[model samples]
Structure formats: structure tokens, C-alpha cells
Target: MQNQTETYMRRALELAKRGAGHVSPNPMVGCVIVKDGRIIGEGWHEYCGGLHAERNALKNCTEDPAGADLYVTLEPCCHWGRTPPCTDAILEKRIGRVFVGCLDANPLVAGKGAQILRDAGIPVETGICEDECRRLNEVFFHYITNKTPYVVLKYAMTLDGKIAAYTGDSRWVTGEAARRHVHETRAQLSGIMVGVGTVLTDDPLLTCRIEGGRNPYRIICDSHARTPLDCQLIRTAHEIDTVIAVTEWNERAAALKKAGAHLVLCQAKNDKVDLTDLMHQLGAHGLDSILLEGGAELAFAALEAGIVHKVQAYIAPKLIGGAAAKTPLGGTGFAKMADAMPLKNVTVTPLGEDFLIEGVL
Candidate 1:
């Protein structure tokens, strides 16, 4: 028989998915209330500054739940921020037991919630499906530890490993399914980033078009402030957030600023934008997860800086080989094969005619 802890934790994980694209700088959490082996209530963190998972679940539980067990994907928050402390709610409800999938890494709540429950004479069991729970809030974990947004580098390439043709024509490399999948990905992250080369060549709007997906903030790494003022991103900046990362001030800075782009100035090395500085700035702005779609140079820089936590590559079956074709990564690549990046816990899924390869580095 499946462990009851696992069953309830899995349900909580599913519930947490509803909060994607809405919770930023805060971990996604889900709660399930079970009484006499039957679920009585469920809830998830919906958005920033909104009611948390525990409170939401308690609100939905209309029955007498004094002896019910609560299953939570993440540790219940013990300190107050946007709302009341979840620990206090659990105490008042007289919950009989608690199952925690993972401990909260935030300094304010780290293991304190579980301690409070135990001190209140309530039984608390932790580490149920711990790895899965941590993976779900990987960006929040990274931010709490490193003070930077978790970076994910994603791109679509051909069988020959080229991102663009020699002539820079890359409208549709992957199938429609893969493209739709990319839109879903964009909707889940806090921001989408690309280099100036991609912005100039592709003129992408970088908005989420999926039915239920939310558009993330768009970011451009343009060292010289060269983003065209008339581009789609510039034109739509007033409606959505757009950030322009530049290494030096240029003549077009005032014009781009007037176009509603927030300019972030960072130092340049070898006449290139410093990826590390950009990441720090992004973290300070409360972006806990960032998706990097690139024109090669940016991907290589992120990889070189050791900041890319995950990589998603969509590979089409067709072959397009040319000496000048742009590859997915560009920079001073490693000199030896042993120095190449290694991926673990890899997953390969077929998306229509293309294959989606994803893993952690």
C-alpha cells in the first residue's frame, strides 16, 4: 500500500501547481487537510501578499477539524509578513498532526514552524517526499542560499546543433508542440532574458500566449543600450515590465528610458556585460526565477559564470549544417572534453516531432 504521507504530499504538490506564474520571491506551497482518511480541505498559495496555503485550507474546512491531519508541501510559515503566521492558525485549529514535505529555507521560517507545532503538543512528521518538494521550489531555495535568481537557459536547436542558419533565419526550428511548451515555460518563470543580438535579429515580443499562462517580465542584455526604440518590446513596455541591462551609457539611453524601459547599469569586462552583476541586480528586483533564451553569446556567458541551474534544449529532427551556422553556445569554450558541463537527473520527452531534453548542471 502506498504510504499515506506520500499520497497526501503528492496531492499537495499537485495543488501547488495552480500558483505558478503568480508567486514570486516566495515559495509555492500547498496544503491538504485529511480527517478519518478522507480529504476535508485543500488550498495553495495563490499570489504575492495573498492568503497563504494554510489559511486558505483552514477557511475551506467547514467541518469540525480539531483532530484532522494537515499535509503541507512546504513548512508552514511561523513568522508574519503579508499575512498572519500559519503556525498560529494550525494551533488555533487544534490540528492533531502535520506532515511536512520539506523545511522552509527562508531564514525567518527555517524549521521554526515545525518546532512551534511540536511545542504546542501536536505531532509533526517531516521529510515526506522531500526531494520532490524541494525541486518544486528550486528557485526559492536558490535565492535563499545565494541571494540570486535561479537561472534556466533554454533554446531550440537542430540535429546538427545549430540555433540559427548561416543567414540567421530561425523563425521555426521546433514543432508547434515544442513552441507551445516554450510559451508554457515562459509563463512559469519570473522573467525572460535574451541578448541584444536576439532582440535585434528576432524582434520577439517575449509574451506568454498560452490560455492560462501569465507573461513574465522581459529582459535584454544590451551592453551599449542598442535596443531599437521602435521594437515590439519597447512599444509594449508601458503595458508590461521591461528591463534593459547595459554596461555603459549611450546616446540612446534617454530615448530607451522614455520608451518605458528600466535601464540597469553594470560594469563591463572585455567590452561585454558582466553576467554576475546582472544576476545580483535581478535578484534585488525580486525575480526568483529567470528563463534565458539566447543567441548563443548569452548562454555561453551564463554557463561560464556557473549560474545556469537548469538547461532545456528542444532538438528538431532536421539537419541544417553550415560552417557559419550559429550554434547554441558561443564563447571561449573549454579546452578539454573533461571540462564540459555534466547534466544529472536528465529527462527526455517527445514534443510532437521534436525532443525536449532537460536536466540540471
Candidate 2:
């Protein structure tokens, strides 16, 4: 029974990953129902405000769902949104046993889903293949627990740890493969954010150049009036949508609004923009995960605030040795080694000539 449960859990995790970008406001959930040691049905949540995992699984079932054992990647949602509570659906299906991979972290659903099933006189088991399930929905879990979006820090740098050469002429530091990977990352996120410094220096379009999915929201963090009006990011409306975040005191916010950019005025802390408040605002706007594409100062601020949850470094094999050539975050560096953040479960992969390193914060 344990091995069968593991197999179903693994399959559910695979399906959940496929629904990453599409499932927003709703955590990606996968479900499978088996009876008499035979697989009966399988389903995954495909989009926001859609049928939940249990309902999809039941829909796929050809035979009577009664007495079946249901296995779900995450705890079934208990609250009503666009769809009915999944706990009620499970009860109505008369599933004899339920095996949940991980508990839903949303305050509204957390333990309530499991409790609902239990109260319905159905057998309930949770935390099956727990680690894998939690990892699959890390973004959702982070948001629910921390009240902020999970920040994925992504950047490209040379072997010598430089993002650009001495002159900051960093048109393209990484190879085609790494750049394409960045696009893929952008596509997965609800939004991609950069500092005004990066806008001034690179004037990047900041859109998903990749082919798979829709472009994410492009966000720029500018405080004290740094982003220039003539920046290409403002001029182009090609593939992506753009939003500019400025402090309430910035006189340039109105101009940016006039230029057809979504402007968010947030509070500043210690002369720097308050990223925490910015993240909550994005969350309220239904963005659960954000990719922080950097220039150093923004990355450092996010890192210092303990808001960055993942870091992806694309390391190219070249040396541009100098203080000026070093990577952006390395500029001011961490204030102290004690302040240096630690990451766990680091994974490194090679993407063409560059290396992709990712880890949890």
C-alpha cells in the first residue's frame, strides 16, 4: 500500500509541475483515485478558479467512485471560490480512504480540509510523500506562511563573477541557452521585477522571449526617481506587460502612469523601497510568485530582508577581472558574514556553456 501510494504521489507531483504558471490564486494540485489495487482516475488543477483536484479526479472516473481510495498532491481545498469545496466533493463521492501528500498552507484551508473529510466519517491520512509535495508547491506555501510572494533571484555572471565588463557594457553575458532559460523562468513567474538601476543601465524589454507560455508582468522598483522616461522598457509594448513601483514621494510616478505603465506607490524604509509592502501589494493583485531579475542593490535589499526564497545563478565561463567587472550583488556585498543568508537543498545544473545554480533560502 505504501509503494502504491508513493507511485501515485510521484505521478501527482509530475502533473502539478506542468500546471505551475497556469494555476494562480489556486495552488497547483494533482489527484489520483485507485480502488482494489487498480488505478481508477487522475487529474490536476489546470487554472485559477477552476475545478479542484478531487473533482477532476472524480470526473475521470468511469466506474462508481464510492469506496475508492483518493490520493492528492496537496490537501483538498475546503473553502468555496469559483468551485465548491473539494472536501464536500470527496465526501459525496464516498471515497473510503484519503491519502494527502501535503497539507494546504492557505489559512482558510490548512487543516480545515482534512478536518472536513474526517467529520464526514471518511478515513483520512495525510503527509504521504510529504517532502516532494511541499517542494512542488513551494511558492504557494511561501505566500501562505510568509504573507509575501516567493522571490526567485536570477542573474547571469562571468566565471570571474562579473555580470558585465568594467564599463558595465553587459549586453549579453551568458550564452543563448542560458538566456533562453531565463525566458523560461520569466514565463513561469506571475511577475518579473528589476531595479531602476537595471532599467537605466540595460533598458531591457524584460519580456519572456521564450515560446512556451504567456509573458509575465514586468515590474520595476524605482525609488527617489531613478528610472528614465526614455528607457526602452517604457517605449516597447511588444510581448509583455509592465508595472512601475515608485515611492509615494516620487514626482515621476505620474509621468510613468501617463506613459501607460501600471504605477504602484509604496512606502520607503531607511531611504530604500519597502519590498515587503511591495510583495503584499502584488499578492493582493493575485501574483503569488515573483522573479527578481537584478542589478545588485535590489538583489541585496531583497536578500537582506529575507524575502528572496530562491536564487538562480547563470555562470558563464569567462573572466573579466576587476572590481567594476564583478557581479552586481558582489558590489556592496553583504554587510557582514553573519548577515549572509544561508540556503538549503542547493541544486546545480548545466545549461549549455553556463551553469544554473538554485537553492532554497
Candidate 3:
């Protein structure tokens, strides 16, 4: 019975992921209604302001959900915001038992949803695959708990740690497989961040470029607002979302706005844009997560700011050794190996010829 419950909860988690890149500031939730050891209905959060998973599952069921068991990835929300309390729906549906993957980290519903069910005399069991469920909504949890955006630092470098050649030709550092995975990641996050230097040097479009995948909000961390009006991002700003983050507004910032870019001023420290301030601004603007695709300097600043939550480093098998070549991170690095930052929950994957190392910072 325990193994079967885990299997059902795993299915719920998979369904929850179907809402990836669509719901932000709201956790992805999936619900299943089961009766007599058979699945009756399954549903997941579809969008930001649409129906929630529990209510959708109750409404989608073919057979009678009354006196049946209900499983949900996250605790059903008990407060009224965009919709009424999900507890009301669960009670009305007459669910005999409830299985929850994890209690919500949201202060509003922390344990109230389960308490409500318990008060109504339904057996509610939580913490089924609890760790997996919590990690699945890390972005939403971080936003609710810290009121800041979760940042992931992503970069491609040679085996020798060089991000680019001596001439700064960084194109195709990783293989086609790794590039495809990057596009997939861009689709999952709410924002894709890069320094203005990356725009000027690579002239990258920064779009998802994958079929049926939506492009994230393109954010350029330009201290002086030096993003070119002719850049592809500026050209397509009207069609796709683009933001220019700057420390001070100038004529060039006005020109970029006139060219259809949205300009935001961030706090400055040490004569440069403060990455922490930039992250808070992004969070307040409704971006729950940011993928920091960088030009070494920005990556280092993000790390130094202590705002980077995850790292994705794609290491090519070939070596490009040169003192003049750029590495994944630059600026005043830690003076000693003992003072360097460490990662947890690290995993290494082989992407064609390149190796992708991912870890929590």
C-alpha cells in the first residue's frame, strides 16, 4: 500500500510539471481522484489565473469522487485569492481521504489546508515524497519566503575553464545537444538575464527558438543603458518582452525605450549595477526565477552578491588554454580555495560530447 501510494504521488508530481513556465508566484499543483483502487480523474494547474488543480480534478472526474481518495502534489490552498478556498471544494466533493505530497511553503496555506480537512474529519496525510514536492516548487517557495527572485547561473566553458577563446569567440562552446537543453531551460524559467556585454559581443537573439516553447522575458544588465537600439532584442521588444536594467537613466535609455524596450533603474554599488537590487526589482516585477546567462563579469557579480541559487556549467571535452581567454567567472575571485563557494546536490550529465554539471549553490 505504501509503494502504491508513492507511485500515485509520483504521477501527481509529473502532472504538476505540465504547468512549468506557465505558473509563477504560484506553485504548480496536480490532483488525482481515486476510487476502489482505480483512477477516476487527474488535473493540474493550467495557468496563472485559471482553475486550481484540486477544483479542476473534482470537476473533471467521470465517476463519483464522493467517498473516494484525493491526492495532491501540494497542500490545497485554503485561502481566497483569485479563487475561493480549495478546502470548500474538497469538503463538497465528500472525499473520504487525502494524500498530500508536501505541505505548502506559502504562509497563507502553510498547514491550514490540512488542518481544515482534519477539522472536517477527513484523514489527511502529508509529506508523501515531501522533498521532491518541495524542490519542484523552489521558485514559488523562494518568492513567498524571501520576496526575491531565484537565480540560476548557466554557462558553457572549456575543460580548462575558459568560457571563450582569446578573441572572445564564444559561439558553439558546447555541442548541439547542450544548446538544445539550454533552450529547454530558457522555456522553463520566467526570465533570461545577460549583461549588455553579452549582447554587444555575441549579438544573440536570446529567444527560446524551440517549437511550441515560449520565450522568457529577456533582461539585459546594462549599467549605463548602452544596449544598442539596433540589437535584435530591441527590434523585437514590441513582439517579445525585453527589459534593460541600468544604474542610471540617460539619453540612450530614453532612446532604447523609444525603440520599444522597457527600462528599469537599479541600485548601484562600486560604480556598477547592484546585482542584488536588480534581482529584487525583477522579483517585484513578477519574475519568480531568472536564468543568468552571462559574460563572466555578470556571473561573478551575481555570485558575489550571493543571490545565485543554482549553477549549470556545461564543460566541453576540448581544452582551450590561454591566459587571455575568458573563464566562466571573472572579477576578484576568492583569494583562497578554502574561501571559495561550494555546491550541494550536485549531478553530472553527459550531453553528447560535453558534460553538464548542475548543483545547488
Q: Return the top candidate by lDDT.
A: 1
- What tens-digit string does per-residue lDDT give for candidate 1 at 1-361? 2487799899999998889878877889999999998899899999989999988998999687799999999999999798989999999999999999999999998999999999999999999899999999988899998888898999999999988789988878998999999999898899999999988988999999989888898999999999999999999999989999998887797789988999999889678888899899999888888999996888998899888999999999999899999999998889999999999989999999999999998
Report the C-alpha lDDT of model 2 over 62-150, residue by residue, as the tens digit.
Answer: 78889999989999888888898988888888999999998888888888999988988888889999988888888888877776678
What is candidate 3's lDDT per residue for 1-361, written digit by digit as tens?
Answer: 8998988899999999999878777899998889999999999998888899998889899988999999999999999999899999999989999999999888899999999999999999999988889889988889888888889999999999888889877787999999999998898899899999999988878899788787999999999988888889999999999999888989999999998888889889888888888888888888888899987888998898999999999989998888999888988899999989999989899999999999998
| RMSD, every candidate, angstroms | 1.4, 2.3, 1.4
Worst 10 residues of 2 by lDDT: 324-333
Indicate whether candidate 1 or candidate 2 has the larger TM-score. 1
Order of quality (TM-score): 1, 3, 2
lDDT values for all models: 0.91, 0.83, 0.91
Superposed Cα deviation of residue 242, candidate 3 (Å) = 1.4
Candidate 3 colliding pairs, count: 0
